[model samples]
Target: MDTTTWTLEQVKDRISKGQEIDERVVDIGQNTVVKFADNVSAEEGEATMFIARMTSVPVARIYAILRDESDGVTYIVQEKLRGEPLINHLPTLDTATRDALALELQKILNELATLDKGHMGLFGRPSQYGSGILAKFDPPVPPIESPEDFLRWLPHNVRDNYGRDEAPLPTGIFDFSRPPIFSHGDFVPENILIEDGHVTGIIDWAYAGWYPYFWNDYIARRRSTLMAFQDGKWSQMVGQMMQPFPEEFRAFQQLYYRADSLL
Candidate 1:
């Protein structure tokens, strides 16, 4: 949409009556879509805009971010990707196509890795939105400086379940020195858009931020619904595409499995 000609108020009005593409998304026009909701992560717009500025990353181009402060709703208008979600085409994809996509993912992850500025939260400062990693918290966890800090912040119940031998999250394993890398937190097929054999856009960046590299692998595997589809080959593909932090991931799995207890 043309942000120059349309005001935020106008966008808000249009979104209120827009044709629903899904629960929170609307097809605003032939070339754009609008994602609006009271709980939409504000950082998603920033993430998309940031990725749009990067030459290598294939992400939706955010046109405008309008927050209706009075109603606590946020509207993000962004480019409509040319293709459908990778999930839709995964079953039909050939090995060659999947391999190409894997290579593309490797490059995208490399681009994200370049953003190691030591920030351990969202891309920018003072992240108010809850991430997938800590969404169970009522008020949400804030940015932390170290992995130990994150471990200390874990709920006692989940903490108690962990063995003393675990690294990163457990107290015994000591070295928490890995610098946080920028991650797309949710790297499942549904967030990936593919046209032909190439990735056209990576959307739904609500969980995108700086975190341990393992977060990508663990979260991708943990959150993936690909088990029923392709017999879990997609998850295996993601494991190969991202960094492997098997030790840290095994520890994290225990905590994540108990995440609902925090609620």
Candidate 2:
């Protein structure tokens, strides 16, 4: 039997079995080739997609499909690119295209800033802390019990960087804690798509959640923290660019960190 080709009858049977196949060839935007023959859904890269759906961000589009389907639930999809990925195409882009891409991304972030709170749904499934609130923020910390101990146990990083001495608090000692916004918790370039000079898609929502907006930056720095960005990994570069977002997005990322109680 040819795995690459399937009859519609075979596909219908497979789908009726609570699954789908690579029954048809689907070329998205421009470059992505999707094959659904055996009742399977869209498969991208080495991952198989199922139960995928698409939504729109203010400036970016979202696509998510289940990456795995063992739970009787498939992963989500929010990405579809028309042209080649930045990694495959970056070296060839003219400065104008590069700048245009960056500026367009910035505009998208700006639109995200004004989003309705309901947009937080973009995060998909929540692990705890009620989705965007982040369970980490509410994690139990051993009591300092006394001012002296409180001074002693303060995280060196927080003390050195976030201390009030260098800068006045943005609000109450906790006022920096703003409400969560819709965040592409796992912001990265692979999850983003650019066609011509404009961003066409924001894919991958498995890690989507209401995080302190700063998470985009934090996720971008995964290389430094996880040692995953060695040897010019494209993922690392994508995460790095996530840092230059405007201040409002910076604020959003900050909340994401706080969601992890890192702040």
Task: Give each model's whole-structure lDDT.
Answer: 0.71, 0.41
Q: Candidate 1 — which residues are off by over 4 angstroms?
A: 125-129, 138-143, 156-175, 224-226
lDDT of 2 at 84: 43
Q: TM-scores across all candidates?
A: 0.85, 0.45
Off by over 4 Å in 2: 1-81, 118-175, 223-263
Residues 54-118, candidate 1, lDDT per residue (tens digit)?
64787777778878888899988888888888888887888888988988988888887886455
**TM-score of model number 1:** 0.85
Winner by lDDT? 1
lDDT of 2 by residue, 1-263 (tens): 23335334443343354322133433332222333323332323112121122224422222333333443423222233454445445556676776667666655555555554432322332322222333223343343222222222334324454442221222222323355554555555555677776776655444554444444555555423444334444443443345433453444345334433645
